[model samples]
Target: MRTVAEVARMIDHSLLRPELTTGDIETGCALAARYRVASVCVRPADVPLAATALAGTGVLVGTVVGFPHGGNATAVKEAETRLAIEQGATEIDMVLNIGRLRSGQLDDVEADIRAVVTAAASAPVKVILENAYLTDEQKIAGCRAAERAGTRFVKTSTGFADGGATMADLRLMRATVSDTVEVKAAGGVRSLDTLLAMADLGVTRFGATVTDRILDDLDHRLRDRDGWTAA
Candidate 1:
């Protein structure tokens, strides 16, 4: 039985839609604050607004660097990271160059991630694998590249992909990376049961647009006390 607060703590409380208005970002930040979520993941352009909205609260302000796709140039990603840091983003979730990773250009992939990590300075960088596109071998290679690049976390997907995080991918990532680095399971995480299952698999963070729904589910279950118990 995952509690509302427990589920909140694991969520990134995502608001990455390009069509999301400024008011939507504000609302998302407010929800994150009210729930005490781990972070609010918004688009790079909205980082400053989210940061301002989340001020005085301990919740982190996270933004994507390479965004939904990792096809951008390395210099672009670096500049994006630097700009995001300047805009008060505390965490950067960067998309790795899937093309490069799949081409077996491991050094290029590592360099791309390293550039962002360097630009981010003291802020943590999470390299998104966009797992739905990769083979198991490619996934392992991506994790290894991110690990070598000093990424703080290796994330599962962008949610734009056809699929999202899976238990198989989660376990593979956990086994591949250093225990010191974190695993953020993003994409399609919807219910309390799935969240708890991922947590059990060593995922510390989750990115989801339906975070409030998950919280609501937890609340409803706890209030009923008929089908579930406290976590």
Candidate 2:
């Protein structure tokens, strides 16, 4: 049975909404600290704030590059990585250029990811696949590109897309990549049961804004002696 903290550790509290204020990022950081989540995934500009708020709290600071859409030039993405890292980001979740991949530009896609991976250097770089728009072949291709670029993780969804992570995609992504490349599922993981189900599919990390709700539900279920079964 997975305990509350066990599930909490897999979450990267998402604070990427463009409308959020600095106050919101600070509050989100506090929640991450309270739950001891894996990280606080924030906007690139908010990296410094999150880093300061999470300092010494053991929660790693993470930020996005190329954002919801992966249309940025390779050089720009690399520069974003450098700046975010200087601002205290330890992990970068970069979006893969979906258009390039769909256009059969696998080499370009791989190079785009490599640029960020190189800039991040020692920091872990997660390539966001934005699976909502890809075919199974396309998703498999995306996984191969990420692996070739040495991405630490291949993530599903940007949450801005038409759909989010699904069981089938999770299975495919986990199967295509070697064990060295971890998988992360973002979006629509709003409950304890859903999270556990994805974890069962070999996902090692998640991006979420509903951290408190899921953990609170898990805590309540445990208090009721209901075991790990979702309430």
Clashing pairs in 1: none
Evaluated at residue 36, the lDDT of candidate 2 is 95
TM-score of 2: 0.97
The candidate that wins on lDDT is 2
In order, candidate lDDTs are 0.92, 0.95
The sequence of per-residue lDDT tens digits that candidate 2 reaches over residues 1-231 is 789888889999999988999999999999999999999999999998998999999999999999989999999999999999999999999999999999989999999999999999999999999999999999999999999998999999988889999999999999999999999999898988999999999999999889999999889888778545554
Error of 1 at 80 (Å): 0.5
Q: CA lDDT of 230 in candidate 1?
A: 46
Model 1 Cα lDDT, one tens digit per residue, 61-161: 99998888899999999999999999999999999999999899999999999999999999999999999999999999999999999999999999889
For candidate 1, the per-residue lDDT at 231 reads 53
